[model samples]
Target: MEREHFSRQFDAELNDIREKLLEMGGKVELMIANALLALVERNTELAVQTIAFDHEINRLEMEIDEKCLEVLARRQPAARDLRFITLALKIVTDLERIGDQCANIAKRVKELNLEPALKPYIDLPRMAQAASTMVKEALDAFVRGDENLAIKVCQDDQVVDDLNEQIQRELLTFMMSDPSAITRAMRINYISKCLERIADHATNVAEMVIFMVKGKDIRHTIA
Candidate 1:
């Protein structure tokens, strides 16, 4: 009876950690979406709010890390339980970094808003949407233990990459034609790169999810 009670308590602790991680994931997703909206709509207030929200993400990361340590020390989980805790630690890092990228994009958006409008933002928003979807799907895969959904997240990264490349080419052409347009072009280029990096981090989480589910390390595997 004592052992069963301890087991139940351990499971509750794990569930709490999972809930906190999901909360962090959802905030990061909102940051990504708001950063793009601020850029496209020239809403400086939203951009500032997005930047401020990063502090909360950072706090949640620390809290989650502490919880994982507590579980390790108390539960001494093995096998699948051990894998899940370790993966949670890594996933929180990626999510925090994703928050950083969103903050970077928000900062750039504020700078871009000060200058004249660049060309109509066409591909950048699409890239942001694709990257955001990957994040949401990756977290869902983690919660559901759905390896197939995680694999799909890994495959979807190409869509963001292609859009980023196309945006860079278009921005370069504008800079080449109008020497004065270089400043705005460069800012847009940096924002595009941030969005691409966010997608890469999301892919990292998806790869880790695959490892947790399948016990196979698939990072950098050609697929």
Candidate 2:
């Protein structure tokens, strides 16, 4: 029954990690949504609050990491269990970075609020929605052990990238057409960069899901 006892403990640890990941995912989603809302609504107060929540995301990341390490040390899980722990570690890192990106967007929103509106709220919010959707899909893929869903997330990254590029080009045109628009355009540029980073983090989550499922590192492959 020794093996059975170890299996039970291992499963408990894994379940705990999964729950924490879900919690982290929920918080990050809220942060992203709030950050975007802060910009759209020009609410500096909400932006600041979103920035503050980032610290909690960092703390959750560390806690999840510590638990994963504890499981590794105590159980020495092999095969799929090992993959689960490894993928969890990678995923937490990506999620934490996504949190930072959300904070960065909030910071940009604060800066942008000091100036008059550059243009109508259009592409940036659309890009944010797509990025947030990708993050949620990637997390759902992990939860359901669905490689197809993970691959879907990976495929969606290109749309975010395209949106980023479009935002960049449009901002460039704004700056070029009206020299006075440079300052506001620069803030939009930074916001697009933040969205781009979020998409990258989503891609990282997809890669981890693939690794967890296939036990092969496809991180280097361009798709």
Q: Which parts of model 1 have CA positions greater than 4 angstroms off? A: none
lDDT of 1 at 209: 94
> Residue 216 in model 1: shift from native, Å?
2.2
Local error of candidate 1 at residue 19 (angstroms):
0.9
Write the residue-wise lDDT of candidate 1 on 78-151 in tens digits.
99999999999999999999999999999999999999897889899999999999999998999788999999
Residue 203 displacement (Å), model 2: 0.7
- lDDT of every predicted structure (CA atoms): 0.94, 0.91
User: Model 1, residue 8: what's the lDDT?
Assistant: 94
Highest TM-score scorer? 1
TM-score for all models, in order of appearance: 0.98, 0.96
What lDDT tens digits, residue by residue, belong to model 2 across residues 15-134?
999999999998999999999999999999999999999999999999999999999998888889888888889899999999999999999999999999988889889999999999
